[model samples]
Target: MFDPFKDFDQAGYLRNLYGEKDPQIVRGLEHTLFRTGLDEALAHVAKRRTLGYSDFLAVHRILFSAFYPSAGQDRAATVPNIAVSKGNTVFAHPLDARRAVEEGLRIGQDKAALRQHPGEVMGWFAYGHPFLDGNGRTMLIIHSELCHRAGFCIEWQRTRKTEYLAALNAEIASPGQGLLDGYLLSFVGAACERQLWGGAIDGIRGLDGRSIEDAVDGEYTDVRVMQKYQAFEMSRAMSKADRR
Candidate 1:
């Protein structure tokens, strides 16, 4: 079992409402509910005049409230003492998760910046790694909305999962390098109507975000974990300087 939260006994497998232990079974149900939740979330966001950090959490709530008791709660609030990572990427410390997400939104909301630095914005969101689950789907919906407002959209249909994931991972490891932006630029196209986006998103593969199963967990206070996060910060700082 990939227990990223390290509270499988208490949280019941990422705090799922059903208390499901089987990954495969949980995923099956996730897909079904995610579809329904996506529609609701899209509607909720559509009504917003401007997206903000709170909207991000609201999206998570709308997407998984039925399935997860901690749906809208950020890692800072729910798992502040636990460190989480996926593969080689260490996410922002729980205390900094909110800042990471806010940074992404700050850039993504600017149409010009988003067009030129979509990857940077995406990297921040991925780095934020807010909720224990549903981070992927929540961000995608918000991203699509940002794209729509900006007059362009990523043709996710053409982007392969492996290639996209590689770019995402690369962006996380080396922020502001344009690795993801360059890859995503090729797939950029005219934005579709918002009403049509629901179906388009639903058709895309790997919407689950995969952080739930692939994440490696450690206590935030662990020396190794602290080092990994500190290293991530140092690397990010160097990358920021390089961009300047």
Candidate 2:
């Protein structure tokens, strides 16, 4: 049971408004609640002319505040002393999570850059792993919007989960590399209208793909944890330097 917050009141799941304690049941309720909230979330994103870190937070808040009380709060502010990881991949430190996400936003805001380097922009967001929950869905919405603004969108429906995940994981592990970029380029197509995006988002297989459940938490002060994060920072720095 993954409990990154260490506040799971029941069955490794965070406390929810429905008062569900069973992980299985919570999963069902979560899916329903999130779907119920998608229209609002998408509408909110559609109205936004510009995307930023705060807008990213707002997406999570819209989709999850009805369920998780900590909906919009990010790791950097809410869990600053914890380090989060999935399998062998350690994300940015809690304190650095916001900055990492901001880096992605800065790059994505450039329409030209976003069109050319969507994977690198998304890699920073994934590595940042900002929110305790709903990071995947929130980022997807933000990413789709950015792509639309850039005059193209990924044909996510045609992409295989396993392959896409592998590429995404690689991108996060080594930013500035074209691993994900190459994988995603083939799927790029003319942008769909905003009104039709709801169907596209709904067609997505897992709303919270690879949900936070797979994330393991550790003390930020742990020697091994600190070492892992340091390595990631060093690699990120090198990637940036190379780009410059």
Candidate 3:
């Protein structure tokens, strides 16, 4: 049993980050769609879906395009063309880039049995920084998707910018998942309970990984909008955190 008001509060917090015209509406839609996407992604995970480098790139592209439409960047088209660099520099070489994605997927699967730790996954994605722009946003969505697949939720309550960035930076420097593990366990636990008790409880339960049809029902009428706002807010918040 989760507390719905808390979920709404989280949505509100994210909406503030997005600076939406109608924060409530924006938060509502973004939260909804994000949940739907999470369900779909989790289903893929449950089916043992092994995502290739290209697949990971595609997911990031879709997530960024949807969340930040004004970016005018083609992440998917650029992923294959972009090479990973070595020696701790961001986007250093192609081989490193490919290895990063591969490692991310492997780590994601390996940690599937444990509590969903989005910070670890996100740290991997951020360290990989697969794309030039929207990396943070992409990581959040990808991590959320992975969590949903693992039968858990990402609780992002009272998450400040400094803390999030520090966690990410620590991972980048050490290549360990402990920092992220702490964040996800704390954040997601709160978020799950919030969703369960919120009006979206039914919507959350009805979320099917195979499709969005279940999420589109009247019960989730406001969910799509909520998800959009939530993504926007989460991205903005994460980026702000990274800068601090």
TM-score (all chains, Cα) for each model: 0.95, 0.91, 0.48
- Overall lDDT per candidate, in order of appearance: 0.84, 0.80, 0.46
Better of 1 and 2 by lDDT: 1
Model 3 lDDT per residue over 1-244, tens place: 1111233344332123453445345435544545445444334433546555655555543433444332323323333333232232233122345566566666765546436445655666665655544355445545555565566766543465557666766655445536766765666652243233223432333122221110111111366544543454355447547655
For residues 1-244, what per-residue lDDT tens digits would candidate 2 score against the true structure? 7676566765246556665667777667666767777788888877887777888889899888877887888887777888878777778877778888898889988989988888888888998898876777788888888888889998887888778778988888778888788988889999988888877777877564444365665786798878888887788678767767
Candidate 3, which ten residues in sequence have the lowest lDDT sum?
Answer: 211-220
lDDT agreement of model 1 with the native: 0.84
Rank by TM-score, descending?
1, 2, 3
How well does candidate 2 match the true structure in TM-score terms? 0.91
Ranking by lDDT: 1, 2, 3
Comparing 1 and 2 on TM-score, the stronger one:
1
Candidate 2 residue pairs in backbone clash? none
Pairs clashing within candidate 1: none
